[model samples]
Target chain A: SQQGEEDPQALSIQEGENATMNCSYKTSINNLQWYRQNSGRGLVHLILIRSNEREKHSGRLRVTLDTSKKSSSLLITASRAADTASYFCATGGQKLVFGQGTRLTINP
Target chain B: SAVISQKPSRDICQRGTSLTIQCQVDSQVTMMFWYRQQPGQSLTLIATANQGSEATYESGFVIDKFPISRPNLTFSTLTVSNMSPEDSSIYLCSVEINVRQYFGPGTRLTVL
Candidate 1:
């Protein structure tokens, strides 16, 4: 079964704007991770937030987890054209389960 | 972080034929995973391969269709059997290191 579902399947924004993508999962997880894929290539791990932690920050990326709602959101500040790619959210369980993903486009 | 490599980055095969994709990791790992990403879609895990054991497949997937082999901690392979056009997709292999998962470049398979 699919564990995560991301909304706003696609988003297009200006380079300096902030992009926010939300993900919701069904089951309890030890941690939730964010990944980025460019041009259908390999995935790059971004950040991971444990169930015990509500929020995490890495560079210009910010992740927030709400365990009660079984949801999480990733915020990329001052996005660049290079940030254009597919963003995926994965829930850690017996195995990693990926979300549908958000296709983000940054207009320069 | 683990540096992983996959063989035959892309291949074109006809229906009824099979293509075996190989994955090799720089560091020894206990578990390796195979995932499929259909055209314009998110990734779906095909199976989890553990060294010296049979692969555990997820629902909607079976060993017959996607046979996997994990001979050692650093190497694994997945073969797509009896291919069809629907089987065209990117197959990726990944391993977890320091609890964080890293992926290979992936094998792009196109079945005609």
Candidate 2:
């Protein structure tokens, strides 16, 4: 069974707006990672945060991990039309277990 | 980052037949995994491909139904044996590089 539970399965926002997606996992994890898949294609690694780290940023992506709560959030700032894609949060390092993804649509 | 590729990006196979998807990594990797993703669904881990050994399948998955071969560090193959319509999904192989993971272009299989 999948261990991660994600919220807001779908979201629509205007270009330049900020988008946030949350994921909560049932078990303790050593790290959490985010990935984006476009048009049912191969996934692109977005960002990964270690359990010891609270937050990390990469370009327009900001990810925060709260190990105490076993939850993590991904924030996309200044979202662009190209950011329209399905995003998933995965737990476990080598044998990753992915959560049901959040579909984000950036309306231009 | 690792460069991974899977052959026969997509295929339509007849029921009861089998299809083998090959995954090749640019560099040698210690860990490789296979996953199945149904339409608009999350990825479900099928098994872990351990080099020079049999794969470790997850719950509900077995070696006979999905036989795997990891002949070396940079190459692995997953075969969907005696496929059924329910096996229609995107099969992806990924490699773990330096604690990070990289995915290959998925092989979309449709068992008719």
Candidate with best lDDT? 1
Number of the top-ranking candidate, with DockQ as the measure: 2
CA lDDT scores, all candidates in order: 0.94, 0.93
Q: Tens digits of per-residue lDDT for model 2 on A20-106?
A: 999999899999999999988789999989999999999999999998899999999999999999999999889999999999999
Please, what are the lDDT tens digits per residue for candidate 2 over residues B11-106?
Answer: 999999999999999998877999999987999999999897779999999999999999999999999999999999999999888777899989
User: Docking category for candidate 2?
Assistant: high
Model 1 spans with C-alpha error above 4 angstroms: none
Q: What is the Cα-based lDDT of residue A85 in candidate 2?
A: 96
Q: TM-scores of the models, in the given order?
A: 0.97, 0.98
Model 1 chain B: ten consecutive residues of lowest lDDT: B94-103
Residues A2-105 of candidate 1 have per-residue lDDT tens digits of 78689879999999999999999999889999999999999999999999999999999999999999999999999999999999999865378899999999
